[model samples]
Target: MSEDHQPETGEDETVIESYVAGCPIDPELAGQIVRLADLPWNDRDVTDSAMRGLGWSDDEVPTDEARFVTAAGHVVYGDYCLYLPFAHSYDVGGELWPDDFWGSLPGWSSQRGAGREEFEAHVDASIDRFAERLGPPECDVRTEGRHLAIGRYSWRYAAWRRGGNILVIGPALDGFSYAQDEEAVVYIGEFAKDSPFPDAADFLNLMHT
Candidate 1:
């Protein structure tokens, strides 16, 4: 799909676009996911049971939001999510570090037990780990920008598909803004028919076997 599928004008679309980029799924399906994710699920223990099966103790489970283990082994958090399948080599540096959730990285700051060199090394290791699961590198490392930004191209999930090499951008305000391509973001709304709890048991059992 080309990147031109996103709406170019409208108030609601503008607001939604900030959180959602290029969504290939049906509008109705996307709406369903968003609505389901927004629900409080206040009168139920739906999320609890799923987390327990996924090896999460009661303490690790979040009360306000939910976390899901993607088929590729990366963890995704939130209901209304923007899934970015990581496909490019990054060039992040001090300019992009120590801000928002990106600052949460272990060595983004000297106070976090790492200097600039150590932090860059940590990022290299992370890239290596991801590459091992995905494939070869296409671009070299770059370091320019106060905010972490991708280049003009990146592969994203086609639609409602799951698994594979991807970065799950949650309904988080701090960590995301716009993809370099603008249309590389896929809006994901995950929900269950019977309940809001994730079906971690089935996947957990599969993982064990």
Candidate 2:
């Protein structure tokens, strides 16, 4: 079946709850649900094996997508159905680094907004820091001007890196405007342990859970 097909568990009622509440669905749970829906048989042996492989008990697993919304009202959508874990933010300070005593560089201004050059520099610095902490395998960087394609939004640029696995960053937007000037936001996504760019829906689905 196509990846976009909603799992049997994702009912209209669940969609309503997610929309009204603004809660994200859990992707991990969704993955399990999708697998269950696609199962050829309902036999105990077959179900048990699949559940075991997913590291979940049948009862613990969600039967449909409706069960995904959290009390906070986050809705998981897309391949992995992963939610944006924390509120979106351009302020990477405390989130990405806690004890590290590094400040934004002089040439880089998160305030003036980052251009291609500035963005590239910032990502390079981030790579250096990431490497220092995790050690490095491989890395690459790219930048572009504003452009809109998918949907109506315009992405400033896109960056992809591969070390132990794939790490994507870019198309940073005006978080304040998007969140009504209340919350800062940035779009970042990680792929499977060693995969490049996750199956979009699967990745988003995982985040929701």
Best by TM-score: 1
Best by lDDT: 2
**Candidate 1 residue lDDT tens string, 1-209:** 22232223542321311111111223333333333334333323554344344453333332234354322222334333323221112222233321222222222211222233432333344344434433443222231222334222212111122232122221111233333312112233333333322222222121112
Residue 177 in candidate 2, Cα distance off native in Å: 2.4
Which residue segments of model 1 deviate by more than 4 Å? 1-54, 57-63, 66-76, 80-113, 137-143, 147-165, 168-209
After aligning candidate 1 to the native by TM-score, how far in Å is the CA of 63 from where it should be?
6.9
Write the residue-wise lDDT of candidate 2 on 1-209 in tens digits: 12222223433332211000011224443334434434433244654466457653333212243213222232222232222211222222222322111112111112222233443344344444434433552433232222432123222222233322233323233222322111111122333445554333232222223
Q: For every model in order, what is the number of clashing pairs?
A: 1, 38
